[model samples]
Target: MESTSSEYARFLAYGNQLIEVHIGLRDLLADLREGVVPAAELGAHCLAFCAAVTRHHTGEDTQVFPLLAARDPGLRSFLAGLEHDHRIIAGLLTRAGAVAAELRDGSTADGAARLRQELDVVAAVLETHFIGEEKRLVAVLNAIDPSVGLTALTDQAVEFR
Candidate 1:
């Protein structure tokens, strides 16, 4: 079995990757707001970000959370709050997705601005969610069922891969 700290270290590493992606996506949003990004680039980035977020949330909802909840009573209760945040973030992305499609089809400057605002909302809400998750659950995650949580995370990541 992997050491508890190692499993948590791996989990935090994944969280850090998402954080990096969000930072990049946030910069892309800022560029869109400033009208600095080429429309083609902006549209492409938005599509990629939407896809990335959907996959990330799917992994959490389907695989990771369930595994964590099995061993930790704490995690099960926290799922409600986490899922709520997920819904909010996903809605922001859905709205942002519409704006991206408009931009791709050659909408006006306001179209891009609208998407940028939506993306900012996603960034803010997701950042808070992610930070809370790390503080409240990341370390304890390793102590949850490693055979379950790690295996599920690995299997789901393969499916996602």
Candidate 2:
């Protein structure tokens, strides 16, 4: 019984950490969208945000999702849906990064507007994805075995530049 409780605690921590990472990513995107980061540095900031999000999704796809799917066959379809979101997000990030680069290079007269649009789309999709993930997975994650080392869930902490 105590072992089961410990497992719940450990996996719950993983779920909480996942949400924390998502929040951090959202905040970074908000800063970029709001022009909180200097105009000159917007390109660099956008790239950094893109990288952070990629790392987080990659970690979940490679580590967390596999473990969960293996533990519960029922999660396979749900995990696949999340993976689909990741692919869509990856495309959006690439588009945003290209716009940012064009802006930095002074090659696009409307780069800022285009970037903002891309960011808005990214933000909307991300918000939906995060909410669905948190709602569905927190309870599922809380039931995973504690023996599955927490390191398996680590996504290399999100870094802000």
Candidate 3:
């Protein structure tokens, strides 16, 4: 019984770590959207944000999702949906990166506005994705065996800027 309790605690840690990453990403997006980063460095900052998000999704797709699917065959379809969301987010990131490049090159007078628009879309989609993922996966994650090395699931920590 003690072992089961310990495993439950570890599983909850995994969910908490996942939420922490999402919160960090949300904060970074808010910073970008609020113009907290100066124009001179906006391009670099935006690119870094995109990279961090990409890394998070890539880690989930490669490490976390596979493990979850293996643990519960019922989750395969749900995980597929999450993977689809990752692809959508990837496209949004690419668009954001392109706008950031334009801003860096000083090629567009309204580059900031364009970049902001792109980021707005990304934020909306991410909000939906993150909420849905947390709602569905937290319980499942908490039910998994703690001995399964859950640390590897979210080990690719996003560096907060």
Assess candidate 3 and give its TM-score to the true structure: 0.83
lDDT of candidates 1 onward, in order: 0.67, 0.81, 0.84
| Models ranked on lDDT | 3, 2, 1
Rank order (by TM-score, best first): 3, 2, 1
Residues 1-161 of candidate 3 have per-residue lDDT tens digits of 23544545655776888899999999999999999989877888999999999998988887677767865789999999999999999999999999999999899899998999999999999999999999898878766765654434343432211
Can you give the lDDT of residue 70 in candidate 2?
A: 65
lDDT of 1 by residue, 11-123 (tens): 65655655565566556556655668775667667877787777777777876677567545576778878878888888888888888888777776776667778777877
Looking at model 1, residue 80 earns an lDDT score of 72
Candidate 1 regions off by >4 Å?
A: 1-36, 143-161
Flag clash pairs in model 3: none
List runs of model 2 lying over 4 Å from the truth: 1-10, 145-161
The numbered model that scores best in lDDT is: 3
Error of 2 at 73 (Å): 0.3
Better of 1 and 3 by TM-score: 3
Query: How displaced is residue 82 in candidate 1, in Å?
Result: 0.7
| Alpha-carbon deviation at 74 in model 1, angstroms | 2.5
Of the two candidates 2 and 3, the one with more favorable lDDT, higher being better, is 3
TM-score for all predictions?
0.71, 0.83, 0.83
